[model samples]
Target: MTTITLVQGDITRQSADAIVNAANSSLLGGGGVDGAIHRRGGPAILEDCRRLRASHYGKGLPTGRAVATTAGNLDARWVIHTVGPRFTREEDRSELLASCYRESLRVADELGARTVAFPAVSAGIYGWPMDDAARIAVETVRATETSVEEVRFVLFDEPAYEAFARQVG
Candidate 1:
């Protein structure tokens, strides 16, 4: 069985095959997890994003989609960048939030990654509630089909850890 684990720490420090970035559509880098990944992962990741922007994703990566780039200075071999939709009351965008996890795993599978780490995605600056974010993350990863042997949710704090723990338990 594919194991799902939760860790409370910096996602950038995890030594998995790939780490999912809760990126903005620009993918050039933004606040929260995106900024941390790009900053710690170094210029190589940004260079790749620039190339991606210059080449294919000029309009920027659409929300709910994912693309991979080199991990740069991080322990992981790859960084899977996915844009998470901002939470809104006008429409239900829960599916898009779930897609971040699904698409990241797809990218990881393409890279033959056996283990991957993910953040809380929209739960941060995008304002998706932590409980709902945890629910979608866990449920989507549990239901998705992939070759990844381990999926770790590398949360940054105690509340995030407890939220994911409730879902995992």
Candidate 2:
């Protein structure tokens, strides 16, 4: 069975096989995880994202939607960016959020990524509670059907790490 690991550190600092960015639909750059990833990866990511966002809109993110730019300043080779839900409206937040995780894993599998890392999507500025967000993340990873051998939750705080650990460990 595939397993998840909880690491207490910065998601932007991780060097997993594929690192996921909780992006806005625009995919250019926004606050929270998207901003952090773009900043660490440098302007190249934002440039590519700007191109993609120009024509990309709506749901499901085109399934195999991903772009491989230079690591900029980060450790990973490819930054697999995916647009997750905003949790702004209280409708179908769970399904939309779960779809983000599932779609990210799908992208990773296509990239032949054996290991992938993710942040707590929708938990930062979207206002989802930490534990609730962690539950969705853990469950989505478990439910996903992919070739990935390792999944890491690169957390920003001790509380988040512990919550993910309890589910995965």
Candidate 3:
């Protein structure tokens, strides 16, 4: 059984075997957690992302899918980039949102990452409600089977942290 933990801090600073980035499809980098990881993780991270863009992800990564790259300057061996779905009331894309966590864990298992730090996928600029995002993330991680010994949700703010805490509790 994996132990779920919550931390109200920057995901970039977490020292885990893998850090999950809530990246956009572009994967080049954007605002929020994606930009933070790219900036702190340094050029090597971007270099790997560029290589991935040139080869496997020419048109950008699809939503709900995930891939890994060098952690660069961050305190981790690998960075798992997962694109989250944009929330909308017209359609239910919760499955895709849940996939972000599931796929990231899948990649972490592949990298032999026993400890992983994750951000709230789509809860930031992507407009997914903080509560729903927290619920989905916690529930998915609880349900998924992986080799990870610890899964830490590194939230960036009090609200995000509280939301995840509610679900975690």
Candidate 4:
């Protein structure tokens, strides 16, 4: 069983075996956690992303899907990039959001990663409600089976931390 932990801090600063980046479909680089990871992890991450784009991810990474890249300057050995679905009331995309966490773990497992740090996924500019996002993340991670020993949801703010805490508790 994996132990879930919540921390109120920057995901980019977390030292784990892998860090999950809530990336856009392009997977090249975008705002929020994506930008932060690329900025701090240096050009190596973007170079890997570009290579992915040119090879396997020609159409860009699909929503809810995940891929791994070198961590570069970050403390982690690898960075797992997963794209979260945009929030839209017209359609129920909760499963897609959930898949972001699930797929990240799958990739982490393949890489023999024991600890993973994740951001709030779709809760940022994607417009997912923070509370609901927390619920999906916690529930999905708890339900999924993997070799990962610890999962850390690293939040950038107090409200986000509290929301995840409620779900974790």
Say which candidate scores most in lDDT.
Answer: 3
After aligning candidate 4 to the native by TM-score, how far in Å is the CA of 32 from where it should be? Answer: 0.6
Candidate 1 ranges with C-alpha deviation above 4 Å: none
Q: List where candidate 4 sits over 4 angstroms from the true fold.
A: none
Report lDDT per candidate: 0.95, 0.76, 0.96, 0.96
Count: clashes, candidate 1: 0
- Model 4: per-residue Cα lDDT at residue 61: 96
Which pairs in model 1 have colliding backbones? none
lDDT of 2 by residue, 17-122 (tens): 8888877666768898888888888988877766665655424244224444444677886777766555655465787778778877887877888888888877
- RMSD per prediction, one decimal? 0.6, 2.9, 0.5, 0.5
- Which ten-residue region of model 2 has the weakest summed lDDT? 57-66
What's model 4's overall lDDT?
A: 0.96
Q: All candidates' TM-scores?
A: 0.98, 0.86, 0.99, 0.99
lDDT of 1 by residue, 96-133 (tens): 99988999999999999999999999999899999999
Worst 10 residues of 3 by lDDT: 21-30
Note the residue pairs that clash in candidate 3.
Answer: none
Better of 1 and 3 by lDDT: 3
